[model samples]
Target: MFRFDWKMTLFVLLLLPVLIRLGYWQLEREAEKRDLQQLYEERQSSAPLPISGVDWSDKDIGWSRIQAEGYYETEYNFLLDNRIQSGQVGYEVLTPFRTDYGVLLINRGWIAAGPRREILPSIETPEDKAVIEATIYIPDGELMMFGEETLSGEQWPKRIQQVHLARMSEALGEKLIPARLRLSAGSAGELSIDWQTVNMQPEVHRGYAIQWFLMAAALVVLFVFFSFRRKEKPNE
Candidate 1:
């Protein structure tokens, strides 16, 4: 014999789809992460290209390996605040580089914030013409993250939450290449170099999917147990 409860069944019917959908969503993310990592590896193996030669209109300029022969714009510099490395809070050093092709921002890498925020680290920029090899990295929605005052300040090294190409171009009085060149390890003027293609591993996404699915299964089991009932004989 079976017992049917319309209210409980309706509630489950509405919720089951949502839980199952979430599980599938995580699985989709897992697959996408795998694809992105593969692309990164492939790009890394290729030979480096000149920064100015590549077309900037492409959607993914983040992983480009490029060479720029130029001198660091010593006067203007930016320190991206709230960067963390090895459990220590720090800042990312960003210096403007003037190349023959164009002017672009170069991320020298992370540096400790020192004992206090007010005490800025002394960056050693090369006054002479030098060449650097690096990979381009443009964060998503970088424009919205900045404000009108982000590029403003009397200080030589401005502290900012994020880089805005339009604001920076206006401040520096030069149109930049629209991405930050992350200096490669061992490159001239490089500091700590540790960049990851994907923030979360694909396996972690799959594990989350399993947890959501397990909850959905438990819901089904409870609904089934309540639906079944034992038949009793009536006494004479």
Candidate 2:
């Protein structure tokens, strides 16, 4: 009678979770690719809606935690550090725009940090404030941290870069719209767009998922190959 090794069985069993997780991830990624393809097709094939909501809304939505970064701390991080762009600290200057149908939030842009905490910058705020064609997005507020330096819902003197979306919402005292708009370039006070800050493509994740799955597959194959080779060899 042959004796079975529990260690080999345990090793194979441990691979289950990795297999399940990566298998699910691969499936989810395929679904996303299909969904995006369908969305693009609808946009192309269907008659355009006379009144369209911000197209760039979710495209720019990112994980937020308000931690300042950059040489001058002159950038805002979006979507879990997905994208960053040069903008200063101040009120996150928001403006309402009346579209053909209703109103929507427009993140006109960020203001440069004031000379000191309370000293407002001399930059001009848009006076005409109507619906200028804008790019849509969502702004993440500050993230809460467990430390002495962590302060929630309080204004600070120096530049306060952070990721706390909830804190930002509390400070603003408004249920922020799900999305914001970036005023088009050449629009009043048009700020530069930092392309480097865009979130990584979902495809990158799919590729990673594939690599993990392949590694798991290789392990299983090696296990089987060794087991069969041992059975075929003559006993010493």
lDDT of 1 by residue, 1-236 (tens): 68889999999999888989999999999998898778778877898888767777778766879888989898888888888899889888888888888887889899888787788878777788888888877452233543356566567777878876788787787898877678888877787767766678899989999998998999999889888856556972
Q: Give lDDT tens digits, candidate 2, residues 1-236.
A: 34366798688789857776886787686666556545544543443222343333445322211111111111222212112344333444444344444444444455554567556444344444332444433332245646533334344322334444344344444444454445544555444433212233456657777777888888877777766664545766
| Backbone clashes (count) for model 2 | 25
| Every candidate's lDDT | 0.81, 0.45
Index of the highest-lDDT prediction? 1
How many pairs collide in each candidate, listed in order?
A: 0, 25
TM-scores of the candidates in the order shown: 0.87, 0.51
lDDT for model 1 comes to 0.81
Relative to the unseen true structure, what is the C-alpha lDDT of residue 120 in candidate 1, on a scale of 0 to 100?
83
